[model samples]
Target: MKQGFVKVAAATPDIRVADVWHNCEEIRKLLSEAEKEGAKVIVFPELCLTGYTCQDLFTQDILLKEARRALERIAQQTKNSGSLVFVGMPLAVDGELYNVAAALNDGRILGFTTKTFLTNYGEFYEMRQFRQGPEKARVISYEGQEIWFGPQLLYQAEEMNELIVSAEICEDVWSPVPPSIQAAREGAVILVNCSASDETVGKDSYRQELIKGQSARLMAGYVYANAGDGESTTDLVFGGHNIIAENGTILKEARRFTNEMIISEIDISRMLGERRKNTTFQTAKERNLPRISFTVNLEETRLTRRFGANPFVPQNMEERAKRCEEILMIQAMGLKKRLLHTNSKTAVVGISGGLDSTLALLVTAKAFDMAGKKRKDIIAVTMPCFGTTDRTYHNACLMSEKLGATLREVPIADAVRTHFRDIGHDEDVHDVTYENAQARERTQVLMDIANQEMGMVIGTGDMSELALGWATYNGDHMSMYGVNASVPKTLVIHLVKYYADTCEDAELRAVLLDVLDTPVSPELLPPKDGEIAQKTEDLVGPYELHDFYLYYVLRFGFEPGKIYRLAKIAFEEQYDDETILKWLRTFYRRFFTQQFKRSCLPDGPKIGTVALSPRGDWRMPSDACAAVWMKDLENLTFNKTGGYSL
Candidate 1:
């Protein structure tokens, strides 16, 4: 598979108790479908050959003999299939009965991975029939074949080096220390479970959490195939819940009471990268276990997995609200710690009525409240220059007053004009110097005011701005502590709206709602027809697009081409191919050129997984060349009609 993406499936096929022939046919049908879907790895539920309801029937020698024959036939059925398949069955070795998952690929059995932990308590009577499987590596003869049988067996793909797989039973993952952990430590990037878990009042949710936590802890892709409908319901009901997860994110899940297959593409490279970054995730030096290597035809896997356009922000409303609250609390707590440690009596913030500054002011008020200080101690400064509008200026003053903070307005028109005259710059000319002059003047005012009032200046620049280096050096970019530093522009909108809905003060809510409606702008240039003309998105690309670019680039280390492909899929309906490419190029150019400003970023709390804080999460050279990235973009071919050739 190209880009280390392997298509995998978890299937729950219909089963009948002690009916090996019928079950084998069902398995064959599902296997055929999966192979047709281009699945390289497919897993079936536990004890599917002889249904889990076959309780005491598991002790019968006739069923065992038939199951062995059925397994051989199943292996033969997959001789022409391309996938590496795992099937559950009962096996007896030296008079000891064991539950195992047989790994089959091409015409023969690769190995047998026994269930390490047997569920015997409560509703399960697995221990009544089968004993705990052998923990050490061992070989056993079954069906006239010597299969490597043990709990520490790992199956590796011949062509792809990262596709190392291991397996355990249903209850093994519930153990205090799962075998998956040791298997991962032995370099298994994918874990499979042949599970027959029954459903209860809240067990489904708990089971989902268990699988997600285990996958995250092991840093491996987990495929859980559970016994579903048709399993005997003597004491428990099987829901047939199958899941495919990777690194804590559930990629695909099946509905309960359904005999269906859940398929998704696994990015093995991303998991390996995560493991390599986390030094504390230690591995064993020498596992001293046997590895069974098999070959699957090397072919490109067509991905059907969906990548969210906005990875930093949750799409669900309730989840987004919860995340916003958590991030806000973290920001406030960070500021509170600094205030307490410094023994400062006040916090100085520049109120621009923009999303980032508004959030900074909100966090400052929260920090003051947390420190048991009056909100009046938070000094909100508004500096109006040539580009000042009645709407933003009024909103800035109103927000400060409604929040019970002390508001101070310093008009910088005369100060800037005097400075412009001193520098011999034309008053009518609007250039970088004209705009940066206003930004530096505002920062100078805030810094001096903070010194005068015995407080610290809170920065309002967000992660998106920092990524594109859209801040004036030593201007709005510098602060005593940047509460919104790690937060991105797309998430900032929701955070502000979340505060507006939750903050009960009616006047404060009204001001916040208006601020959310205002267009994002620096307001450095004069107004056109008394309306703001200096829009940030028009000069740069959209913040939504830039934030998307920032996440894949910093979080997963994806190359330009891969990110472009994913972005095209995620934003297909919202944006066109040409528009995406145009902004994408802008994003790369600005992101590379703006690293100098980020190299010396101010102290800010890291609020999420992706951050541009120079002190944490990111460390890039300021002068690094963008030639390699640009070359990749240049190599992207365009059609005669101007669209991407792809």
Candidate 2:
């Protein structure tokens, strides 16, 4: 599998109770189906070769013999499948019956991972028919084949080293210590569970959460295949709730009672990266378990997993509102502490009527409220320069007055012209110097005012701007404290909107809503017909795409190529491959080259997992070259079908 993505499936095929031949045929059909879909790893429910509802039939000698025969048949059926398959069955070892998951690949039985925990409480009578497996792994002869049979068998792909997998049958995962935990510690990136957990009143939700929690705890991919309909409903009904999760997120889940197959590509590289970053997740001190090597065709896995376009913001309305509230509180609390610690008399904010400044001002007001300081002491400065629009300026002044902050209107056009003349620069010639002069001039004004009033200049530059190095150095970049440093541009929009929707003051709400609608601009260049010119997105690419790139690049250390692939999937409908590739290249170039700006960032609260604060999460050499990353993007060639190939 390329990119460390292995397509895995959890299939729950309908089975007949105690009918080994019928169950074997169903398993073969589902195996073929999953293989046809290019699944490299597939899992089935526990004891599917002979249904879990067999009761006394599980102990019959004929049933056990037929199950072994069915196992051999399933193994033979995988000759041309080129997939590592795990199917459940019952086996008789040393005259003791044990339920186990047999690992099969390329026409042979690789190993058998027996269920370690037997369920005996409540409606489960697994202990009656099966005993616990061995504490330690051991090799055994089954029909002249020396197969590894234990709970600690790890099936590793010979092609992709990161595609190591392990299995635990039904009750083992429910136990305090799952075998998969040790399996993960011993270098298993993917864990599969062959489960026959029947449905109860609220068990499905609990089961889903359990599987998600286990994957999150171990930092591995988890695939669970449960028993479905067609099994005799002798008191317990099988729902066949198949699920595939990767690192706490469910990638694909089968509907209950459908007995369907759920498949998704698990990013093994991401999991490995997370594990490497997490220092507390220690591996086993000693490696004693057997490692079984399996082979699969090395091809690019067609990803079925969905990557959210906005990783910083939640998708659900309720969750997003809650997240916005929590983030706002975090911002306010951080500012509140800075204010109290410094005993500052005022919090100065440059209100531009843009999302970042508006959020900064809101946070300042909240911090003032939290610190029991007078709101009038918070100076909200609106610096009108060449690019200031009537709409934005109006909103800025109104919002400041409504929030009870002392509004100050400072017109800086003449000041910028004087500075240009001093530098022997033409006032008419529009260039970076022209734009940066206005920015630096505004910053100079804010800093001097803060110094005069014993206040702190709250930085309004967001995480997106810092990531792209979009802010002017020593201008908007330098502040005493930055409340929105970790907040991304895409998230800033939502946060402002959330405040507008929740605030009780009608004038402030209207101003916020209008500010949210205004185009994001620095207002450094001259305006055209009173409308704002120099739209940021037209020059720097869309913030949504940049934010996505930033999240994956910093959060997971994903390579540029992988990030491109995920971006294509996330924004497939909105952006084409060439556009995504263009923006992605720009993102990497700016991110690497702009480290100098982030190397000396001011103190800011880290709100999310991804941050660029130099004193905290990220530290890099300012001169580090992005050639390697750019080269990865260069390798991606657009094809006629509008897809890219590396």
Candidate 3:
């Protein structure tokens, strides 16, 4: 019931063939349960009141009269329930019978959307009994009330925006053009289907896929309830399958052949945003569409769908491997083209044995190979300064040699010492200037060497770095072409390991595995007693939290409060509420203040869905005000070093 979120359900109730009274009772019971669950709209199977398998019995006046009477009973039972229900039944319209999904709510029939595509092939002989429905809706008298009955009928929720719902019959969805598509164009946020699709070998998967794709195509919430476990087994098997999906994602699904109710909240906000962003979706809006109006009470709904803390990273191992392979190829191929197009035989990459640099160097090797150049053409430069660690230094040199790249070390301590003297800053003071001086000096060395060698300077800074403005402008931030520009820090580690695991060299793989295990740091400050200092997370925020913030902020344009709400669920075990909010504030502050860095980013491949490349996804002004965002975060009240404000 939340603004832009509507609770919807797909219900498959067990029933007997030709049992109108019994089936109507089951519908009533399910309606009561769904309403209690705060479901605004619930859908049942096709011809559910009279049962889809009631073959020749549909022609009998008694069965047809019973179905009409049962529809009345179901409609009457909805008096105490607030849910808009879509239950299937047989209907006689203009002296012809058709399968219709009647919309019932608050003891009244809102409308009936009849099936347009009557199945007449194979085990399905729907056309034998019922004929195709008309395209245009017409008013009909049902239970002493006039209601619209046809394919194009939309229910408008009186209390909610974008909570409009519509219904379609079984074969209507299987038609060349689904009613869901038109329903969406007509502003129906929710599309319910009453399906009595008989199960066959591999039919469940196809049914599932069809519904999911339609939801995605329409950018609407799709609730599919199929008839199951009941009806005649003569030549057809009905395995009741139910699913609730939004934006192509199936949030809740029942086991095939089981009578169950699947419910989930549909974030119309996300779908609406996607449709607005895609031009094809916008074109669908221009066509004139007919709609039947219905309404529901507006109230806040509880979130049921689980949010992933690391949405960028896949949860399953198989998907993760696939994603890792795909992203690695994308990165390498991007760099490959840049090198071949520029006719550069050598690539200049600054390596510190850190994740970002290591990934960049690997990509350079792949790019050179793709360009039909030797690996040594990649000029791997390790600039050791005040913060350089022996472990990373050794690893950088080893990694370069292992990849057959030309390893070169340039000590920047002497040059930074001179720059420190010029800036009148003491080397003892570890500040932004101290760190940025080493960064800029290293960049100068790489750029000049690239110019001398006639190569491209590879950039190691990732999207996470760019989001926080972690790089020094015209220093590490500048490069000829950045392959990891769109890659987030959370994903960079995974991609590196993915490349490592597939390497033919075991030693190289072992070293990469260790690098993956290493803590993330710029390593700008000198080590404290041989231990690495200046861990990036300690200064800014955890990449996990910041990545979460960046994703929701840019991907969905979610408000800070909504993002915070989702974060609690996503990171429940890893982080508490207070900790999440604290880092969230940090993310907003740094992201706003660092836009100046992103404004002048060098050429980089857009690798992911969310990117802030000046020429790509994000084009914000460097000086945009974050005052309002920061103020909202700052005002978040928490307990005294405890959990959220309870």
Candidate 4:
């Protein structure tokens, strides 16, 4: 697979009770389908060769002999399959029967991992037919070959060393201490469970949570295969609830009672990255667990995993709302601490009726409320420069009044004109100087006003701006406390919208809605026919794309090429390959060159996992070069051959 994304499958094939030959054919069909889907690792339910409901038939010599022969047939089928398949069967070792998962690849058995925990409760009679697998590594003869047979066997991919796979039976995962726990501690990044779990009143939900939680705690990818239709439902019913999860997120889950195969790409690279970052996830002295190394054809895995266009923002509405509320509280609490610590009389925030400033003002008002101070003590300043439009200015004035904050209007056109005259610059020539001068003047007004009122200036720049270094240096960049510093621009709009939906006052809601509708800009360039000019997205590219790039690059440490691949998939309908590559190159260039602003960032609460706060989450050298990143982007060809020259 390409980019450390190993395609894996959790398959549940319909089984007939004690019909080993028929089950082998079913396994063969599923294996063909999975291999066609480009899955390198495919797992089947526990004891599927001889159905879990076989009851007393499991002890029959004829049935055991047929199961072994079926396993050999499946092993031979792997000669041309090119994918590793894990199938379940009963193995007799030293006159004791044990349920085990046999790993087969390349015309032979890679290894056999016996189930360490056998269920003996309620509907399960596994312990009656089998003994507990040994904890230590051992060898057994299978088809005249010495096979590693134990619960501590790990099948390591020789090509992809990070893709070490381990197996456990159904009850083993539900045990107090799963074998997968030690398996993960021994560097198994992917854990497969050959499960014969029967569906009960609410077992499916609990099973899903168990799989998700274990994968999260272990920081590993988990594949669960359950027995499905055609099994003897004498006392219990199997639902075949197959699930594929990676690091707490279930990528694909099959419907209960259905014979289905769920194939999804598990990001081994991301899992390993998370494990390395977590200091508590320690690796113990290797149990000297016998490892079976195998090789697979190396090719770029066509990723079937979906990447969200906005990773920073939650896709679900309820989740997004909850996240927004939590972020608001963090921002408010951070500001409240500053207000109480400094004993400031007022909180001054310059508002342009844009998303970031509006969010800052809202958080400031909340901080004042939390500190048991009057909202009027929060001063909302609206500075009208050369390019200020009627829409934004009107919204700003109305918002401050409705929120019961002291509104201050400072017109800066005259001051800017005087300064330009002093510098002997033409007023008609619009350039970076013209734009930055207005920003500096506005910041200067806010600072002086805060000093006059015995308060601190609350910054409105967001994380997206910090990443792209979009703020004017020493202008809008400096502040006493930045509430929205860790918030991204894409998420800032949602925060404002969340406030609108929750606030009971209709007028405040309407004004916030209008502010959300306004074009994002600095309002430094002159207006055209009284309309706002110099849109921020037009100059710096879309904030959404930049935010997407920022999230993957910072959170997952993804390279430019990988991010580009994910972006093309995530934004296929909205943006084409050319547009994605164009903005991606711009993102890399700006992000590296703009680290100075982030290196000296103001105090802000780290609201989410991905943050640019220098004191908290990110600490990067400002002088680091972007040459390597840029060169990778330049080399990307972006064609049908998976977008790279390699």
Q: Pick the candidate with the highest lDDT.
A: 2
Candidate 3, superposed: residue stretches over 4 Å from native: 283-290, 631-646
What is residue 613's positional error in candidate 2, in angstroms?
Answer: 0.5
3 versus 4: better TM-score goes to: 4
lDDT of 2 by residue, 132-192 (tens): 9999888899999898988879888887777899999988889898899889999999999
lDDT of 3 at 501: 80
lDDT of 4 by residue, 410-499 (tens): 999899999999998799999888988899999999999999999999999999999999999988998999999989999999999999
Which ranking of candidates, highest TM-score first?
2, 4, 3, 1
Worst 10 residues of 2 by lDDT: 154-163
Question: What is candidate 3's lDDT per residue for 146-254, written digit by digit as tens?
Answer: 8888886888766565677888888888889887777788688788889988878888889889889999888888888988887778777788788898888888888
Q: Which ranges in model 2 have alpha carbons more than 4 Å from their true place?
A: none
Q: Candidate 1, residues 190-228: lDDT per residue as tens digits? A: 899999999988898998999999989988899999999
Query: Please, what is the whole-model Cα lDDT of each candidate in the order they appear?
Result: 0.90, 0.92, 0.85, 0.90
Q: Indicate whether candidate 2 or candidate 4 has the larger TM-score.
A: 2
Ten-residue segment with the worst summed lDDT in candidate 4? Answer: 637-646
Q: What is the lDDT of candidate 4?
A: 0.90
Clashes of each: 1, 0, 8, 2
List TM-scores for all candidates, in order: 0.96, 0.99, 0.97, 0.98
